[model samples]
Target: MSQATPPRSRRVPRAERREEILAAAARVFGSKGYRAGSLAEVAEQVGITHAGVLHHFGSKDRLLWEVLEYRDRVDVEHLEGQHIPGGLELFRHLVTTARRNADRRGIVQAYTVLTGEAVTDGHPAADRARTRFGVLREDIASALRTVADERGVDLAEQDAVRAASAVIGVMDGLQTQWLLDPEVVDLAESTAFAIEAILRAVLPGVEPLPDSPGASGAP
Candidate 1:
């Protein structure tokens, strides 16, 4: 007996289909690396033809950027869903994100591999990676300042910027360490520990961190 093959149509809604394509592309690129990933492969994964994939993305490079942007949005969404009462809390968020990244191996691979390739001039996601990190710093800095306002302590602009940058740097650095040795780093736990040490610096007069990063689980 012959089985029915589902028809491919734009009926899934353009935006949703685009997300599906981007998610599939991320997994493929994460596994194969950008240069090695091809439209044919992505199409195969999406249950479509190469032409069908190009119809939505124009080209493989465009598809890659969409995947990066998707990841960036997810990252921002995670932070948006939480409240960090002080600068140290922001650190806690970053550290917890590191832990979550470690737990989700595929995402960690996708982010690390794409960013590594992104450093090359003219790489499709190079500008996006730069913009994404800059925006992330701004978001965290804003929250830190809010904490400062609440505490009635005004840190110098340089201090806030430095603190935000330091948090981002530590996260990126720790992610790499965790990637290299998950057993040794256990990124999430280590993140909480590291950020806990910085608590005194950022929350000088604020109430202490809750028993568990304000009830957020898995970063």
Candidate 2:
């Protein structure tokens, strides 16, 4: 009897292997958190030895930063080619972001855990996190200013800055709650409601942010 040839395995490129490792690392860190997540778990997920993972990523801290960068890259891509969003548009965008986050617990958890860790002075990602917040604040302030101008509301720059800060606070706080008790908290809906309230205080009679289609509400 003629022997059947063994199936040949295709070799992944070096870059491809690195990407696969990063994806597995993100999932592990997201689920187990940075301190609890281990290199072995990540390597196992990627079908590699622990040393192989280190060969690709150099160190766990560097890997964590890369994972965060990957998440941010994906997020920026999600908003690519979109129009410059104003107040209501910005709120809608944020609610949409929350809804999307609900589906990706891993990434959200990683971000949440890392942000808390970054508070310690001289943490590896501390500067990166602070820079990210600065950029977000600027974006929110710009949107607020646009909305105020469009509504003919006399909102001071300082007021807009404060409002931007409050908006970030609300989003992060709600995300933490939703992570802790997803069944009790509807992140997207709650965020939308809070944003609407803020808008009402700033621009009375302004149109509401649009609802997410097919959203399960509080579920």
User: Which candidate leads in TM-score?
Assistant: 2
Q: Which residue pairs in candidate 2 collide?
A: none
Task: Estimate, for each residue in 1-219, the C-alpha lDDT of model 2 and write its tens digit.
Answer: 012211224366899888877778877876776578899988777776799889988998778878877765554454535332555666777777777677766667767877888999898778988997888788888887787888788988887778788888888888899989999999888988887787677677887777443333342
Runs off by more than 4 Å, candidate 2 = 1-18, 27-38, 44-47, 82-87, 211-219
lDDT of 2 at 16: 81
Question: Which stretches in model 1 have alpha-carbon errors above 4 Å?
Answer: 1-10, 26-45, 58-64, 75-93, 121-124, 205-219
Clashing pairs in 1: none
Task: Give the per-residue lDDT digits (tens) of candidate 1, residues 62-120.
Answer: 67667766765664454545333344455555655565565456556556766788999
lDDT of candidate 1 vs native?
0.66
Q: Compared to the true structure, candidate 1 yields what TM-score?
A: 0.72
TM-score of each: 0.72, 0.75
